[model samples]
Target: MKFLKNKITGITIVLIVILVALSPWIIWHFKPDRHLDVLVFDKTVPQNNYREHKGFIWLLNSFKYTKLNGDKYGLLDYFGFFPEPNYKYKIKPLPKDLSKYDLLYVTDTYGVYDRDFYGTSKNIEGERSQKIYGGTQSSEISSIKSALENSNKSKTLIVEFNSLASPTDTKVQKEMDQLLGLKWSGWIGREFKTLNKNNEEIPRWVFRNYRKQYGKEWNFTGSGYVFVKNDDTLMILEKRKDTTKDMTFKFSPKGQEDFGIKREVGYYYWFDIMEKVNNTESIADYTFFLTESGKDKFKKFGIPTSFPAITESKIKNHITYYFSGDYADKGEFPVVYQAVGLPKINSLLISDYGNTDSFFWKIYAPVMQKILDNTYEKKSSETKTASIN
Candidate 1:
């Protein structure tokens, strides 16, 4: 009788221990839908290199909730955290219910993978040496296109094709062109000077005109050959003007604005630029911030006075935003990391884990936060999404 009683107590204690161990997962599984369901289509990131890709991975990690172990990730932690975005990282096939997720992030490396992005993958190759993948997989681009098409909430789709090298797959390029309301004109190599903020002449590409965040302004000047042509559905809400005062702020480039916000970003000296096209509008543009000699050289190439640097458009109820460059490059990430307050999480990955801010908070984590803040608004529940079959 004593032996049997002891055995029953031991089993009960073991069962209680197991239940306690699994409680967090159980609570999450049956929990009410309070958090945003964010889906990251992350196949665009290449595995094998750890250092270069660390910044990108750090960005993704910022969206995640860390687990108790702190050093390793369990199954529950792998899916993501609660309260804000319960991010489910999907790489291969698109999820079945297209409308289920609140936000979709496609890295859109096109075909060329960044050597820096290769950095993190190299560090992760201890288990399987042969399984390391570098470039985007086949059919993945088509799958993303299909997802966008099938999703009525396509506006929630956040994508940036970071590569200047056009997709060798013409089909991918064509689909992106039609979808973005601009035709990809390939790459360019040049230098960009700081926008003349105090000159009283508002440069066509000055994007820092937004009211301000935390009572401050920020802008980037990078040379990437990203050219685009507008389609029939284009909307140039505000055409390129020499200078104009819109929204109370006057056009005073040199003497008018804070000096800290206006700086040059000249990586990928030769990059891609775009022209406005169908069903789209240009909100930001490239400035002629060149020296007389540089201007003469650019003119010889027959480049236009200015081109749209930022643009937006709607397709099938989804609103997609496009930019000329990415914030993941080596030159830009450090500054962004400092601005975002994670100064140590760059070039090298930091293992210290904790809960990160929401998407709205972290979205500004990159250089484009200002642009997004002024342009894209959070979608209300009442906002209508297209019905996809």
Candidate 2:
């Protein structure tokens, strides 16, 4: 009897040990909140109403993205503020403690809160109180500055949907300018079209190609864009800011540096262009923001500067990837004209996201991932080493 009793006691002890060994893995695999925290700024795009922008969704649905018991265990399981734990109540201000997260994403353009805050003002009672209003307060910008400043311990990435509105609140714009070393000017319109192959849009850049079946083909050749930088990646759609070198170019059917390949039928329509921030002089030290064309057109509009859509910035352990243009809003905008909202299509301005994919994203996302995946500092022993090489 004593031997049998001892055997039972031994089995119980072994069972408890097994449970203890397996508990963490089980909890993390089945419940992500058990071990992850994240701070995300998901202010609405004000235009992507259908939720067609799948950039965030793609990361979430990825296979083994949140797997535990392996290297993938520490992936972005607790995304910005939404995965409310089983019984935790949602609140306005972020939790006082954010040392637990591995990544912080401030991914939006205009700080739209309760429509009334910006855009078409509306009265959505309950929703307005909850949002971080555009220009909520200088304190909010201070918070973001503090987070990025203090993020020496984690990988921090902030993507401004509309780079112009890094911090939409006017109150915070000054703080943001200091934090990013860049300032919002105004939207620069690009003149490009979606690559509509047959009935399907491939969701990628189709180079400088369009159809002129509806209007005079020669007038719509999109003649102004000249090769400033030989970067084939960003050189696709033309209509770069007017440049002195652009006065003379061999006219071609294909509309490239070389002439006479084939007549590429296209259109000359205005687009919502994003320009480099105001601190063009300081930007060269960090990331060389895009280049301005023949002249600073925005100066006439009060922006005082203009540049193409390309940018990169790094601050201490916190690195920011800026997409000067809003890729989500496909390069499509019917306007009176880019200068002063002249008018296009009609006297009214029409806005829409073209197809399944945005041409800007095709080139921007991969490059951005390459830049953000690595840590970079200013004038360091590693600065000479390329981030992607």
Candidate 3:
């Protein structure tokens, strides 16, 4: 009977310790919602592709942001995620007025592809199909422009990669470039764990284009990087021969202070090669550890050895940010917005390379959380000043 009593007492003490340790998280989980007014626009939310904007959605939930005139936690103006009941309205148009939104987030403008729409196997397909749908519409770009130009309050704009890439109209893309201080070089690239022809992970078009341009059969089979321009110009950099190490996100000292990220993180996905225009500031850069031969290859193609990973610009009272890579893509994982210390713990456990979750938890979420918090603080201060006046 005494042993039983001691066991029960020990269990109770353990529970108490755990609860004490999680007290801060428990309080945070139940903090009152801030009710931030924001907009999210993504044209590539296909049925099976939830990762495109999953990290963004998780952030929204973390802040308890709500849809306009609604209590829902997510977007009412999203597109391409669901099958359109009416074919005439397949493409979703932007709200007529966006001046009321404190923040505008354009996560993707790449839109739906033939492979995604038709459910084609990810393996190589026939010559590029012309059946892609949706893109950054001219009217949508006009709406964003009007909001920036006419809004009475300070507005913040955030855009991710592929916003000015293929499927988006060139004229509309150029307009966005001017607004956000960007100049797209028309090249997109990604790292492949293996360059073997049988690797289903590699896109078929990349292999086909290289073979056609050089009139040589696909021969190399090793880890490498593949780059393709809008005009089908192909460049491949094999590991060891061209690059000594994987690419990493090298943050500027200012970026580290601003975003509260102190460590370099690996980025192994699609990214664009673009130049910063106007008064844009680079917050971080994609550092490619290329060999001398790799440098020669990039120089031959008129590409730089390194380029901006994140850029920021200020227009009047409005601020805009351009993420040059898939910064918001958090692969399949359960949301844990209420768990405060999980990201810190996870960052310590996960490796920095080839892990999407690590990048999301260690880099993407922290930077975005800092941005949202700072934007809200500034907005609140402005509100208080306006009220006083």
Full-model lDDT for every candidate: 0.39, 0.36, 0.78
**Candidates ranked by TM-score, best first?**
3, 1, 2
Stretches of candidate 2 exceeding 4 Å from the true structure: 1-38, 45-53, 60-64, 67-96, 109-137, 163-167, 187-299, 302-310, 328-361, 375-389
Clashes of 3: 0
Per-model TM-score versus the true fold = 0.46, 0.43, 0.90
lDDT of 1: 0.39
Tell me how many residue pairs clash in candidate 1.
Answer: 54
Worst 10 residues of 3 by lDDT: 80-89
Model 1 stretches astray by more than 4 angstroms: 1-34, 42-97, 110-142, 145-154, 188-271, 330-380, 383-389
Model 3 over residues 77-177: C-alpha lDDT tens digits?
45443444322225555787998888888888776656555654331443355545566778888888899888778888998987888778889888888
lDDT (Cα) of model 3: 0.78
Per-residue alpha-carbon lDDT of candidate 1 for residues 114-187, written as tens digits (9 for 90 to 100): 33133332322212222222233345445545666776443355555443233334565556666678766654
Best by TM-score: 3
Instruction: Using TM-score as the measure, name the better of candidate 1 and candidate 3.
Output: 3
lDDT of 2 by residue, 204-229 (tens): 22223222222222232433331111
